[model samples]
Target: MHLHPQKSLYDLAQQHHLEGLTLPSLLALTKEQEGYSIDKAKRFLAFQGRINNEMLNHQVIIQNPYTAWFEQGDQNPAQIKAFIIQFSVFSNQFLIAQLHKMIHADTLESMHASKEILANEIGVRFQSGQQHENLNNQSSTEGSIDGSRFSFSAAHFEWLYIIAKKLGLSFAEIGQPKHGTHATLFFCNELIRLYGGDNYQISQAASYAVENWAAAGFWKQLIQGLQKYNDQTGLDLPLGFFIWHDKLEAQHAAHTQEELEELYFTQNLDEDAFIQNGNEMLAGVAAFWDGLEVQRQELATTH
Candidate 1:
């Protein structure tokens, strides 16, 4: 969905009478941004919880005394997207997978190892002349969805949709902003094609990412500020689940968080209560992923 004019950072901060950097200005925005309440009533109450903490926690900095998200009240869709990409690149979960530090993030230690995966992935290099096919293959070897491949427990799929929809976005709309996740994936794929990085290869690399980005076109470039992060985090994320997660949504009843944990996380729970609990329809979500296996294999092999 397009962002509302009012949601622009500059616009929002301006609404609160904040247009410059100062303690009063910062204090005012904390009341507005973190003070934002989608479900809560009485904006004043919202301010009380997160406002002071943002400053105390150093989550909101005053360096250079700039006010972009706070004063400008606007973020070009591209800037908002760039923020996600740049920040996510540093995520431990994403990097661990790239470095092959560990298969996936299940434990806190491995998860912590991933904290700098992006920084490392970007700066760390494969030893020259030491690059082995096996190492690159290790990256490719980590299990991936066959376009038809579907292995997530149905409970997982249900969780994504419930979180996404409840947050007022379709799962389809989550990460496709400026350099959306897919765009990043395409860029990596393109760079691999230009493995030598010669002049000729440079053009091809740009060409490849540009083509994919072009195909996605308008909406990809015009992403608005985030609507809800529920789609990005706070839900079970199986790698590349975005591609097939939506397929399960049409098949399940609407769900809430409690039901999802009960079904997937709990040792035992009644299936019927899922409706009240806001879990995905387990049968359909499971079937959808499992059903995609043949197709997934075909896509993986051909692509």
Candidate 2:
């Protein structure tokens, strides 16, 4: 459903305040008011399962020739550079989508859920585990003024920046709109327009599709190619960005499931619209890979 255009972000934030209410308390209140239906929730889960299966088999990124070439350990400097620059366009704008999700969430529970994801995106970690300690030690360049550990090491985009720098990309080349190809720019715009847009359900659907897409092993494929490239070129590329995202996206599969369950339980969903928007978002993603493939072919012909 379309949210009121005039509602400021602050207004939406105010509306979702937990006010000392625990998750269970908020969920109970929502159920009491919304008249929770177990049967409906089950139906939604079934539909969601179909969508997840479809995403797994989606030939867009999964079967794209460019993806296959990269996975096969092909290393073309020009093509790889193009991929890095274009992907940075998407990476930098992702925060806007997360912000939109949090602000446009219909319920406090959903808002909190979105907030947690955003927190992770922005480098907020609740647990100071061994892995984090390793990250802190490894990211010496990101040390603060006093040489203390900073949270930027955990930030996803910061990791991307590190990857870009290792690949010989300048800051201006990574995220600048002018550096993005037509399909890459379209994909980035689509993320904000759908995933970060004011339509709460559509945004959720788009995000669900994206989470599933990420969990479908593309990151692993890219990492394999990148590792091979590093070995062949002796670049010693720090692949923490791809590696961390691969792990996180695996976890996001469960997170997306919970998000959908919460959405099913707490709000009335337009299932048809949700499905349609999700496919549309994936189409944009397909275009992105298609664009890269076109460029890869062009580079091949020149050689």
Best by TM-score: 2
Q: Which residue pairs in candidate 2 collide?
A: none
TM-score of each: 0.17, 0.76
lDDT (Cα, tens digit) per residue for candidate 2, span 190-224: 98889878887788788877887787778888999
Candidate number of the best lDDT: 2
Alpha-carbon lDDT, every model:
0.30, 0.70
Worst 10 residues of 1 by lDDT: 59-68
Clash count (model 1, backbone only): 19
